[model samples]
Target: MRETVYIFLKAPVAGRVKTRLGAVVGMGRAAALFRIMTDWTIAEAQKGSWETVLAVDPPAAAHKRARFWPPRFRRVAQGPGDLGARMARIFRTAPPGPVVIIGADAPGLRARHLREAFKRLRGADAVFGPAADGGFWLIGLARRRAAPDLFDSVRWSSEHTLADTLKTLPESFDVRMLETLRDVDEAADLETAMFRGRR
Candidate 1:
């Protein structure tokens, strides 16, 4: 069976997607940028061999109904809960093989990161792509490291997130880290991502 890569996305509705970048770029523009980033990430992920699923908020994804979607992508709405809870549910219900979850905000992420994470999953219990903002841009779990506390008590948007997450895991657990990338969260991050895209 093919492995599943879950891409998490917020509704591309203006003011709903990029609330952090809302101050710098108006909510409408933030939403637009988010849509573009989502498209780019989805397109890049599609080039890989694994299966793709768009796990939208409340698990109800409008992307599936989106007229612009390419082929072979499925959509599922997120369930009610905090970020940790939702992620916990996915780790719990995911298929037997490794399941990776990636956020939509990392405009610079690419297929190579996914390939590396899957490769690392062979020897480690879990893999994390740490974001410059202190949170993670991607997470992958093999059968061994599926635990709820992995995401608990994480300072969601702070730089301490990776450290906190690491502390939650058992000492016996073998974790792997990947190249850190800047996530388009605050105003500066958005500017950086936009600048990089222009080059």
Candidate 2:
């Protein structure tokens, strides 16, 4: 079965995006950095066997397309409130198949990573690509679970994010683990990403 992959993206607005890295790299450079990474993510996910959707926020669809997205892919806004709320909103909208939600900042995320997630979802109820920082860069779900509790009562963006999410998953659900990857959240992480790429 074909899986629906949601690519959650923030508009590469200078000050609004990558603010944690902003102090070290400056917002101008932070946005530039995010732009490069987001493009890499989109291309990687587009490589094989899945349907792609770009879910963004501050909601003008066409404007998002013109700025960072390709003309062919569909787009949706993240919608009001926090990160969890926005992500839950889209999970509800995805069709009954495997639905994989991924963040925009993982420099190592690639087409094969996504393909493996979908493939693993065949036997698992959920699959997570745990980030070193304790959040997940990628999460995929099979149709049997209702994700309401999946995003609830947790810290968003903190080291506890993944731990909190694990608390909400149903024991009846099967989960698979994927290769861990790093998400670029600061200048140091950016340095690591560049260094790894050069290797």
lDDT of 2: 0.84
What tens digits encode model 2's per-residue C-alpha lDDT throughout 1-199?
5689999988888998999999888999999888888888899889987899888867885355477678788888878878878777877877767889997899888789888998898888899999988899998888766755877888988899888888888868788889888899978897665447735
Which number leads on TM-score? 2
TM-score, cand. 1: 0.91
For model 1, name the residue pairs that clash: 58-77, 58-78, 59-76, 59-77, 59-78, 60-77, 134-159
For each candidate, how many residue pairs have backbone atoms clashing (under 3 Å)? 7, 1
lDDT of 1 by residue, 34-78 (tens): 888888889878878888887777444544466434446777766
Best by lDDT: 2
Question: Candidate 1: where is the Cα deviation over 4 Å?
Answer: 62-64, 67-71, 145-148
What is the lDDT of every predicted structure here?
Answer: 0.80, 0.84
